[model samples]
Target: MNADIKLRVSNIDKSFPGVKALNQVNFAVRKGTVHVLCGENGAGKSTLMKVINGIYRPDAGEILIDEKPVDIKNPIQARSLGISMIFQELNYIPEMTIEESLCVGNWPRDRYGRINWKEIRKRTKELLAKENLNYNPETKLKELTVSDIQMLEILKAISYNSDIIIMDEPTSAITNKEVEVLFQKINEIKSRGACIIYISHKMDEIFRIADEITVFRDGCVVDSRPIGEYDLETVISQMVGRKLENNFPKEEIKLGGEILKVQSLTQKDKFEDVSFHVREGEIIGFAGLMGAGRTEVMRSLFGLDPYESGEIFIKNQKTVIKNVKSSIDKKMVMLSEDRRRFGIIPVRSIKENVALASLRKFIYSGRLHEEEENKAVKEFCEKMNVKAPDFETKIESLSGGNQQKVILAKWMVTDPDILIVDEPTRGIDVGAKYEIYKLMTELAKQKKALVMVSSELPELIGMCDRIYIMSKGKVTGMLTRDEFTQESIMAYATGTKIQKEVK
Candidate 1:
């Protein structure tokens, strides 16, 4: 044990009924440095972090903080010992105001032992302002966007002023600019001699902020070294256990007739006059900055949100889609950007979640054919390479990547002609991302129309046949494959340049 070491774990082992989440994992973090944890989803990075943060008690291990043994039996104990964690899953009281949420754990008290509401509001306002978060403290958290909530989570962790801060996929839902701000905050924390344990699958962030890097695979440490000792290839190879030749294995496909079209879709203040089309076998992309109406447009198109006026056509026939079932009946399905909220049913089993959207196929003679449903679920799960303990395993227990696979499988079983996938690879690792890209390319080869909405520019450029750039509730520019560059896309996204046609 070194005096400079802020946190240390020796031979930590944790397990659940069917999974050994961590196997004799040993790791150390030095004060005043950022230690990055990189691994594929289900690789036990989160599990290890949970053990350290007291969310999960390790079955066997010795945890030492500052050369002293510590037993962190719960989150409260961890926090009391100067440890804080920002979870990947957004957990907050939706009904609570921003100020109430931020001041929940540590509230200022008056002389009478009651909460000092004024002081809390003042402090929360100051905190938000310092972070450049232009949000009202009185606004309920449920009213805020996902990106804003992500920023708030970062702020909440930073507010603790702890000795050790653990952040899991902090930038998964945020924009690049917000990520820059987060990095700056992290650096400030580092300057104060605090230790940061950052868990992310993003290579760019790993390279930018990590002082030391540790790779976890299959619930064990594969490698741990300084940032200088590893390149993107080495880190990725260790994480995925193979050389991924292409993160985006996009294949060219022949264009067919327009399968779906939206003309002048308006959602009052949400989005306006949004028009796009997806041809059979063509992958169309929607690229924009955060809150640029890309998601709103997709939501309206899927009938998740009501639009003031719009005309939707399927195979050149005007169709009125009143709800999700209506859209599904028309052979259209959507993979929402916020998967936790909209995509998966967390409390359900793997088989049930997979068979959710396509239940019609399993229901015969006024009953669900259990054997038939199970067979179909098994086939699709295997096809998607979903890693789960069993068909009965809870969907919430699976890793982020596997959960995404199940969601994809859910829609795939529906045999949709048009798939509107929003942020399909949001929080998953590079390996899982590659798998999804391969799947999308396969779908395109089958002449299925796909519309992809992504904040990641390179993904859109690599996978999209054509891209429509949205800015402030309108389609600012449309680019074909030849013109699909980050610069051109940003030009339209930021409203610096707008092209009228899709050429």
Candidate 2:
């Protein structure tokens, strides 16, 4: 361990053509300590981390490793400098096996530089075991779930014998059990004198694992304090610049006519015998463990997947939602679980993306209503409080939270009869998440029904008017607002609830 500092980044400045991403940013990480980079989305957290890990070269300022300045021009150079970064959007070769993906950059070669398949698999298997990840080394990345592929990425960084590891929203797409395993691995690395920069929007995690907390806002450091100096409320206020008096603003919703009613919605092995009713002015929550098929059920309902047989009713009238187009035609919209994969279109402008699903509504014959569309987008952007250069700006430039807002804007523009949100607040920050919850509340107030699927227990319990627990592709139990409890939900979700208590 260096007596002075393990890593120092001073007055760092980075810009992306027109946008000044980072401004006079100062950051440091001590050896063998967990330093959390805390901030709302697009507060230059990612930019600063990229500067330190060599993804982006700073236009100004210096990065010092062990009291000496160094130039990290590329990822290879960064790896050579004993630095590794795990990005929020994971990078993996899906066609290759786990071992093959890990050994791609620098494989164990025989005397003639030929590939040594036997040694490669052996070492990869042993390394995974040491990290306590149970999976076949030869398992194809495509065959593995998204969570397992993420574990492989982490192991790949450790394989480089890195001393400094930067993790950005590492647990965003992971399961609860996988998170425990990751924390254990992080501790092992810390014990060996490694510095870890943990970047996340979840304040609970920062307080739990961080030695020091640094909050960033608008491309500058707001506070750099020891972990004990902050609590969840204090940290959230610093990050979002507000007191989170009420996280969920769910109000007493009046029961109204049924907006969506599904009868025997079955999707074969994924989810079977699923039946639920969502009334106007209510939030219906679907709760389950990671692979209990909660998301699958929602997707099936939204016409994103093929269902064997089912009948969907809207306003007491039967409708056919054979495909995504038909679903939208029926005035039903879905916010997907995986944002990058299904939710937002990265390459298009914010206005274009938000107005995509319902473009035909504004255009007549061969002409388009440009003014009306802009006015609509402007109104939605204001309603959602989206921060962006312009509605014409590309969706990729905004932070994860803002991108989510754009998705919400798009669905809201469509004016759906029933809204199905799957992991609506997956990677959004605290303030933005609360805003989304409020939006849902207001939508319910407008007699718009919502069916939400979430992994966060508090979210389901706090935001939903009613909760349905699913297990192994079946609806094990349903709980009303009065009966909602973590223990009860878990018991039902795991097939341990009595038949009589299910009602």
Candidate 3:
């Protein structure tokens, strides 16, 4: 029963109609320790977390606090019992102030049931400082950038005085600077005798902050060990049930035709002089740390953002693309990094989101072919292995990995010649990541040019045929399969050099 454990998730099982989301999962978090949860997609990591945080009630098993059995009925119940969670997907009222978000459901009330504004603001201010975060409690969420919103979520969790905190890829969208601040805050919270259930795919971040590690694979716990008991290789093997020999495929393909060539691509403050050429059947990886203007470069290239001076060429012929429509017309599509914000529609069904970009083909004179759309969605779901009861299921109902698969299926259905996947497997589990990697390889086999922007160094080395390292809006160095090394990429990404030749 793990009597000393602050939170014990015992023999939990949960399922949807067609998929067993979680099966007999047991997890625990010791008091005042950073317990990391590692798993491949479909492993039930999120489901287990959802159970603990009262987002989902398990069909079987019980959760215990200090060796006593307790059933978590809802989020409020979990919070009342000193448990809080921050989702990987951010959800907050954009127009609301930071203080408003922190004290919404659990607001301090006066004798007559009136909200105590003074007390709320004071608590908000104190919590933000505890993390060394510099944000006004009155700042609206909408006005702040993605990084700012992430920090606010942490502050809100801290403000609740939660004993156990669950952070699911909390730093996925934040910049490197912001990530440093987040790590500092996490350490501070740990020092203050608070427990954190850290969930992330980023190995460095996991090792840096976690006091102990637990790996989940195929909806089961593989092992739990002290943080230093295993190195990256061992930890990864435990997570996936196999040692990862090649994180990147790094296959050699013939450069028969110049599929895409950018000449002097310039987007005012985003990116400049971003000139590069991608050949048919080649995989070009745009490698950089967070905030290195990688996504900006892809957006500009895809015509989603306005570029001041850039001549794009397809098959050595110049063309002007000023918007998303033109880029699609040119057969180049982007699988956005921010899946929730720019990719999937939460309210829409998986069928609708997948068929969105190319709806015209399925529509005739304002009359839609519902049968055709349904068939297409079903086929794509099968092809991508998107596990759901049916394509009619709301996109939000699917797990993170399934949602990601649906997005990839969306872009692939477009049948584009050039595919730019910005962090395609960012928040997914190890199993899902391998599937994505295989999909990318298949794309290369079909002679389609691919541009991948990734934060994980191993992924870049494993998947890319040739890697271009970017640092602060500029190309720093290019590495071939043989020269694909993390230190080399980090050296360039950190701006230790302008441009260097790799031997």
Candidate 4:
């Protein structure tokens, strides 16, 4: 064992009923550096991290900390050994206040053996200030957005003051500015000789902060090297086991008449006076910062949230969508950004989930036709390339990318005319992202209108025929495909520049 090695796993192996999640793997992390793990979903990156963090006991392996073997049987034991993890999914009690959530497991107690409210509030405020977060300590977690909750998780992990921090897609839900702040904090942690094991599918973030890179594929490590020795193309090729000629495989389609239009959509503090339209055979994008009201507008349009006042025209006919069922009745469906919360029934099988949205179609004589449902689900799953042992497998058992595919298949079975996809490719790998992009293009070719809300500018520019930029609950500007650039989009998204109309 190397003197500087902070953590090491030797010959680690783990398996589930039908899946070999991890092979005989070996990994090591040194002191005071960012070690990034890059791989497709289900490549065993998270599984390996779980083994080190004591979420899973490896079937065969030895774990060492500080050049000595250590037995980590649980997360508490791993924490005692100076290990803390920030998961990709947000985990927090909705009813708990900020202070309570920040000091959840290790609440401060006074001499009387009672919880110290004063100290908790003081420490929470200090921590929030240090992170440049401007939220009241008494604010409940339910009032916060997905991005805000994700930020608190990051703060909680840092509060542990652990020697080894594992962050799984920490920036997946945050804005680019927040990501900058997080990178600054990571640098500070490194300065104190703490090691970071970061996991992400984002190429830009990987190249920006990583000192070392490890690429995983098919439950094994393909290559590990210094950041300086890798390039974007090389790393991507190693991850998917092949070269991708085009990351965004967009296709040209002749757009038809306007299929859906929204005017003056208002949601009080959430969003106001939002207007946009999508034509048949066209893919439109919504681009903005985290709190810029992009997601809010989409939610209202899809009838997930109530809009104060708005006029919606479907196929040039005024339509009123009061709820999700009404929206679906008008041939509109949405794929939510928070997949775990809104997209899937985790306890159900893939077949059940895929047929959830369109179960009525499978009903005949007051009974669900099992043969018809099975055939339909199997066909859609194959078309989406959802890799799984079988359709009977629980949806939660699959990787993030595969879960997303199943969601897409679910909505496709509904045969919607206008599809609203919010952060469609979030938390998935590069290969899976290309597949999603291809699917979107195919939908456009089929003359289905797509309204995409995404924080990633590059994908929006490549995939959308037009884009509408929002800021502070308002639509600031709209851009055609030719006018789409990161700088121009950011200018509109940040309210630096605004155009009343683009004709």
Kindly state the number of residue pairs that clash in model 1: 0
TM-score of each: 0.97, 0.93, 0.87, 0.96
Structure candidate 3, residue pairs in collision? 40-430, 41-429, 94-142, 247-462, 248-462, 248-463, 249-462
lDDT by residue for model 3 (78-178), tens: 99888899887887777899889888878899999999999999988888786667888898887776767777776677657688899987887787887
If the candidates were sorted by their TM-score against the true structure, best first, what order would they fall in? 1, 4, 2, 3
Q: Report the Cα lDDT for candidate 4.
A: 0.90
As for lDDT, the candidate ahead, 1 or 3, is 1
Off by over 4 Å in 3: 1-3, 97-99, 108-140, 217-247, 363-380, 500-503
Q: Which candidate leads in TM-score?
A: 1
User: How well is each residue in 329-434 modelled by candidate 4, as lDDT tens digits?
Assistant: 9999999988876899988999999999999989989899989889889988888788788999999888777888899899988889999999988887888788
The residue-by-residue lDDT of candidate 1 on 99-168, one tens digit each, is 9989887889999999999999999999988876778899998898888888888889898899999999
Clashes found in each candidate (C-alpha, N, C closer than 3 A): 0, 0, 7, 0
Instruction: Give the backbone clash total of model 2.
Output: 0
lDDT of 2 by residue, 1-503 (tens): 45746888889988875577788988788999999998887788888878887788999999989978999897778888889888877655567898898887777899998999999989888888877678888788878767677767776776676889999888887888888878988898889998899998776778889999999988888988889888887788888887875658989988799888888778888887778898989899999888888888778777888788888888888987778998888788999877776777788999999888878989997888988888888888888888787888999878777888898899999888789998888778887888889899999999999999998889999999999899998888899999999999999888897344443
Q: Relative to the unseen true structure, what is the Cα RMSD of model 2?
A: 2.4
Which regions of candidate 1 fall more than 4 Å away from where they truly are? Answer: 109-116
